[model samples]
Target: MSSHRPPPVPPRQVFTDPVHFLAFGFGSGLSPKAPGTAGTVAAIPLYLLLSGLPLWGYLLATLVVIVAGIWLCGESSRRLGVHDHPGIVWDEFAGFLVTMIAAPAGWIWVLVGFVLFRIFDVLKPWPIGWVDRRVGGGTGIVVDDLLAGVYALVVLQLLAWWWQVLMATA
Candidate 1:
């Protein structure tokens, strides 16, 4: 096998592949810097829409996106010939969605979740980093973000509880 590797194609080439299109988070992933953050910002509107649903409905929607993301991420990775390209950010969308599952109904909660998810994703503490390195394919692309979302979810819940306590005591 040749050890030679071709140069990366321009990020905009994703238009040629529908799976890459979604994996790029509708071009938010094309941002020159912090594509993951850009993708998370894009996810804000989607989260708002889904949050309006009943708890089970929101959860079901999250589940559907995660399932779709696996295929989209995997295919995108293959088509681009790059594993976990920084620009392939469907993972960010799914991660933010995971963070907001059954979240308290408030814009503040949404903001908190966003901040927390980004932190965990960037930091990749413990098992999050472990999965990011050891896993492969679409599962690898999306799983780390999902784990970040779970960590953010727990922190958000704790903050919500504390806020309620403060409100009651005030």
Candidate 2:
């Protein structure tokens, strides 16, 4: 393997390519500060649109994003001549959507999902860290975040259940 690395890509250039545009999380990844967080934040609007769909429809949409994201992210990485560049945040987009799956109908839940997803994605507990270290290419890039989303999903679901029980008692 070559140790040579490509020069940093300009933010404006992200818009020039459709794949890069998407892989950059619609430009959210271009943020100089905390691109991953920005990318996850960018996902919220899309999630709002997605949340309106039927459960099956939502799942299908999420699946499409995840599958397409692998390609989008991989291609962008190649073009950038980097591995998992910070600006490639389509993974974050897919991961956040995964966290919000079957979430309760409320902005509060959206907030919870966002926070939880961010935490796991950032912390990369357990197998999340394992995958990030060992995996390669786009699958490697996105899989870690996907696992983070799963972790968040479990916690989010449990919190929702507990909140429901508490409400019932009230």
Candidate 3:
């Protein structure tokens, strides 16, 4: 058995590096424990602001984030000389945005989306796990999470529909 462990990706220099600043989810990814979870939690307020926008506007903004995330996340990983460091969580921000598209109207569902997104992200089932391993650079880093977001989005929509049905019945 080869005990080959890649060296740890160092913490971000949030103040010194702009790429790090964004990739770290404005510092939420810098948390010593569960940085990914921290980044997901930090996304809530941003999601709130974005949710107020018209659906098109929200989707447009999310599109911009995803497109730009490819570069931002890639460069940050390169600068750190690491591939998809746990601390580089711009993907999480972008992923959470993806999960929120057409989400139900309420903080409750937002929380639900967060949990679902996290589950998909952490679990990396199916193509998510495949992409995470097969892809490289920023595309790999962000795409995996983006896929997870898509999965979460589907589950969230289903939940919304179920909720609507329940409310209608009541």
TM-score of 2: 0.95
**lDDT of candidate 3 at residue 112, scale 0 to 100:** 95
lDDT of 2 by residue, 1-170 (tens): 89553455787789888999999999998888889999999999999999999999999999999999999998999888889998899999999999999999999999999999999999999999999999989899899999999999999999999999999999
**Model 3 compared with the native: what TM-score?**
0.93
* Candidate 3 Cα misplacement greater than 4 A, ranges: 1-12
Answer with 1 or 2, whichever has the higher TM-score.
Answer: 2
In model 3, residue pairs whose N, Cα or C atoms come closer than 3 Å (at least 3 residues apart or on different chains), thus clashing, are none
Error of 1 at 91 (Å): 0.6
| Clashes per candidate, residues 3 or more apart or on different chains | 0, 0, 0
**Cα error of candidate 2 at position 147, Å:** 0.3
Would you list the C-alpha lDDT of every candidate in the order shown? Answer: 0.90, 0.94, 0.89
Model 2's alpha-carbon lDDT is: 0.94
Best candidate according to lDDT: 2
Give candidate 2 regions above 4 Å deviation: 1-8
Question: TM-score for all predictions?
Answer: 0.92, 0.95, 0.93
Sorting all predicted structures by TM-score, with the top scorer first, yields 2, 3, 1
lDDT of 1 by residue, 1-170 (tens): 89654444465686666777789998788877788999999999999989889999999999999999999999888887888888888999999999998789988898899999999999999999999999999999999999999999999999999999999999
